[model samples]
Target: MIRLGHGYDIHRLDSRENAGQPIVIAGVRFDGSPGHAPDFELGCVAHSDGDVIYHSVVDAILGALTMPDIGCLFPDNDPRLRGADSSIFMEEAYKRMVARDYRIGNCDVTLICQKPKVNVENDAGESVKQLMRENLSRLLHTPIECLNVKARTHEKVDSVGECRAIECHVVLTLERTA
Candidate 1:
């Protein structure tokens, strides 16, 4: 049997007054702009590295297998998880899937933001795909071809359009291999 699942997440950028460490997105770091809003000061505030791409992907896989979410497995309330690596979430999710005898068919992700331009030239999509493929492949004991990733921008309108934050939507298809 096979199942498909989707997950989405969005986080607002930190204002200059409350700026913190730059949040890593799609494996790229966007150091909050310096100076009292000199140019840009935007970052996601979360317990982990706050990689929306990774978070969304983890949720998608768990949702498909009807497993617990990232929060449930790695709760934010736990001090050990504070500022933990986002890749750990992906690895854990993949482990869970493999334990259930499931294999990943493929995955696609879309990132919505107005700034830091996510495009092929910037290697945003490819970076995410490579990271996910590498980690998932190791955990699933399969090749990297089973995973895929992509990025997109919101044509400047709403919150994401305004570049005030970033959002990611991910979908995954899983099959029972055993």
Candidate 2:
């Protein structure tokens, strides 16, 4: 059996936290400057690392299994979860998938943000996308060929387009292994 699931997530970009600290997305860091330069000035504000891409992927897997969402499984109010790694969420979702005898067939992700262009043209954009793909492949235990990552701007229409927030959408295909 093959099942398709969709996931979406968005987080506000805090202008305050952009000071030198790097914001993690898909386990990769995006900072305003290299080496945590104090001049760095843009990052997402959230309880976790605020990696919308990873969060969306986890949601996709949980949706595929008809399980609770990430917020339910890992509440923001939990102190222990403060600044937690998003990969942990992905791992839990993957475990659930395996328990159900399901494996990932493919996954495609679209990230929307105006400030950080995710193309190779930008210094850090393309590399970050590739890091995400590699990390996701490892997390899902799937071949790199089965995963896809794309980034875009919202054309200045909404929060993401305005560079005030970051959003991600994910589509996951799961196949029954047994």
Candidate 3:
């Protein structure tokens, strides 16, 4: 049996007071990049670590399996979730996938951002897309080849284009491993 799922997430970007780090996507810290402006860089405004990739991926998996979404599993009103890591949400989805004897056959992720170019190598010599692919593959126990990540600018049209927000969309094929 095979299942298909799609997920999307977006967060408003704002200036964080005295935040030393850069925006995090799929657990990668992006700082001082060809897309980062130290003086004007923006950060995601959310209760938890705002990782649009991980958040959307989790939702995709859960939605595919006919389960509750991240918001339902980890409600924003929960005080314990304040500033929580997004990876935990991914973990929960993975556990459910395994319990249901399903595995990711393949997934494609698209990210939209005006700053922090995804293909450009940051100061760490790692391209943001590659870093995200590796991180998500590791977290989901899916082969790296089964994942594809692409990013683009919002063409300066809306909040994303203005660099005031970031968004991600994910689609995946889930196959029965049994």
Using TM-score as the measure, the top candidate is 3
After superposing candidate 2, which stretches have Cα over 4 Å from the reference?
16-21, 32-40, 121-126
TM per candidate: 0.78, 0.88, 0.91
lDDT by residue (tens digit), candidate 3, 82-147? 878899988989999999999999999999989766776665465667778888999999999999
Q: Model 2: which residue pairs collide?
A: 18-42
Summarize candidate 2's per-residue lDDT along 63-133 as a digit string, tens digits.
Answer: 98888988999998999978778888889988999999999999999888886665442243346567678
RMSD to native, candidate 1: 5.1
Error of 1 at 152 (Å): 1.9
lDDT-wise, the better of 1 and 3 is: 3
What is candidate 1's lDDT per residue for 39-158, written digit by digit as tens?
235667777777788788889989998888777887878888777778788788888888898877877777777875543222232443354455545654556776665667788888
**Which is superior by TM-score, 1 or 3?**
3
What is the model-wide C-alpha lDDT for candidate 2?
0.80
Give candidate 1's TM-score: 0.78
Candidate 3's C-alpha lDDT?
Answer: 0.84
